[model samples]
Target: MTQQTKGKASALFPLLIFILLFIGTGVLTKDFSNMPLNVAVIIAAAVAIFMNRKVKLAKKIEIFTKGAGHENIMLMCIIFVLAGAFSEVAKGMGAVDATVNLGLSLLPANLLMVGLFLIGCFISITMGTSMGTVVALTPIGIGIADQTDIPMALAMATVIGGAMFGDNLSMISDTTIASARTQNTSMSDKFKTNFFIVLPGALITALILWFITSGSHINQLEDYSYNLVKVIPYLAVLIVAILGVNVVIVLIGGIILAGAIGIIDGSYTGTTLLQAASQGVLNMEDIAIVALFIGGIIGIIQYNGGIDYLLHVVSNKIKSKKGAEFGIAGLVSVADISTANNTISIIMTGPLAKDIASKYNVDPRKSASILDIFAACWQGIVPYGGQMLAVAGLASISPISIMPYSFYPVLLGICGITAILFGFPRRKVKQ
Candidate 1:
């Protein structure tokens, strides 16, 4: 038991230091961005390597390289690229305006809150990215908030909560792919477990959002009559994504569809199309660069056996099914906090998670679902999370202020934990 405690502390030391530096700096300056999150994550990762006394520096570098270059990160990067290109190309061609207008027209003033929440969920689910979902939807959410006189925090949080729902649950989502692949569970099975757990939380949150915004009223406006042809691309993207088409192909097809429409409508010149694509890709520059660094750093950690050290220590602590579930949660949470990437956390902790599941006879699907869902619940509420950062940038608000409004993530975690305690998603035990 002492050894188990020691392992947890040793594993957590880097994270403790990171929070001290990262959050400490921000609190002292009252500026979250004062200490760059990327730089801080790198520094913390180095410290993590140093803690591994058993591993050599050169070997550590190799592990970090392997983890960073893991096939999963590459796949997420591909999604990021496609999302960037599509959003850019579509925006350049006035698709956003037309789409937003069409949505506004369909959603009555009384249902604005519900409308925004649903839209946020739909877009994130389709986009497989919470940040991209936010960027695409926020300006419009904000406009509606202002025009409707709804509380900004509540409105912003509504969208954020919905976005996280998809980020955590979407089959093509990076977090889902990471956790499922990591735990050696079937993606379809994980989805079943995940959906069952999160469905109630989403329903409850939606009702709450509805209640919260029910008192507010807005003047209804006429729906913008845009060409039905212009709506085809976005609509098609949605339909194909929901049908389980490959995400990369979905994005590429969406881009092509949008571009063709743009050229046909004279909304985009050939030069504009190329320029928008370039510019759109450029928007993801920070994460793209940071992802490369993070991959390399984790590769070193892996090479040094730091990750194996965690596996040894954490796996030893499991004495029961409940303990195993908590351990899975702990593993992913630590990796998520360390990596500052929920999907990466799932990837990093996957092997260990699988081992723990096997030892405890805990359901693999449940294990994977728990890891992804909890990581997202934490990630969504974190001030430093990418979703918060992007939303804060677009909404011009502090992350602290937005935290209270993220009702969906908060409730999702609550309900998810409850699900575990009650064995809520009791699957037929696979003999």
Candidate 2:
């Protein structure tokens, strides 16, 4: 019994060590970006190895290898690679510029802020990535702010909100993929469950944005030239994904189509597409590495009884389906807060959430939805998180300034709680 207790305590320690090293070092340096997350994860992984003295070094290494290469982790890594390639190729072929122009052109001057939010939402949904959406739109958002009476913080907040919205719901999104995989549900099922929960919140956010920015006007309406042909790739990806194509197939098709269009449009010649695709894959290195380390560390933690301990403690408090849902939500939120990465948080909490869901009979789809929503919420509002920092950097403003204006994440959190309290979506349990 003492041996089992020791194993559980040792298993839980690595996560705490990782948190302190990652967040603590960032706090000390006054720059979270300066500390590579991969390094901190590696450190924690090493500590995890050291703590398990009972296991031979070779066996410990074998266990870490198995976790790192687990089927789900490997699948996520493949999607990351493909998604990265698609995003870079699409950007290289001018898809982002065309999409942004097309989106902005459709809205009147009075609803420019709303247009920014919608454009962000559309871009993220199509691209299947929040970071990419923010990177592509924050500059435009800042440009609009500079040319108009709108405040910078508010403008940045709009982009962040829309980014989170798409991130929470996009079928191709890493969070969506991780959530669905972790919960052992299909992405479409999770999306269906998630959509109803957050749709009203999104609509309400748009309404509020329209009201708030109603009085603001652009100094000069900048005319943008959009090539409709360049917009086809994004539309193709979104349509295909919505049709429930295998995610890998969806991304592969996007890459090939984008490359063909770029070649025909004179946007690429010879190896340009190849080079762009390679660069895109390289961009995903950090995330891919972090995923491997997290998987391995989590494996070790589980082997040492860490996950069982967590399940025991959490399951003890779960009295009903609502409590189980809340536990899943709370677990991912705290993990995302600590890691400052929603995808990582989802991966870390996925297995444990499954256990809780199984024990309390929470619907897998709802559990997945709750995981994605809460992770997105915490990620959007946390000043230190990547989403906020990315927008803040682009707008040349403090992340703290972007916090109050993050309406979508805030509203989504409120709605998520309401859903749990009222048992929204009302799914039937599997017999």
Can you tell me which runs of candidate 1 are displaced by over 4 Å? 1-18, 38-67, 119-194, 215-227, 304-314, 340-369, 379-404, 425-431
TM-score of each: 0.75, 0.67
Backbone clashes in each candidate structure, one number apiece? 12, 0
Worst 10 residues of 1 by lDDT: 1-10
Model 1 lDDT tens row, 1-431: 21222223455565566677768887899886677766776787788667677768777666666766767566655655666677778877877666656666676656887877887788787667776566556656666666566877777788788888899888788888888887777888898899889988888887887787777766455445655676677778767766666667877898898898899889888998989888867765555555555566555544444455665666667788888888888777766655557876787677777877887788988999989988888888876566665555445565666887888888888877887789879988766
Regions of model 2 farther than 4 Å from truth: 1-7, 108-200, 207-221, 318-410, 419-431
202-247 in candidate 2: lDDT tens per residue? 9999999999888876565678778999988877876765555666
Please state the error at residue 324 of candidate 2 in Å: 6.5
The lDDT per prediction is: 0.73, 0.79
As a whole number from 0 to 100, the lDDT of residue 53 in candidate 1 is: 70
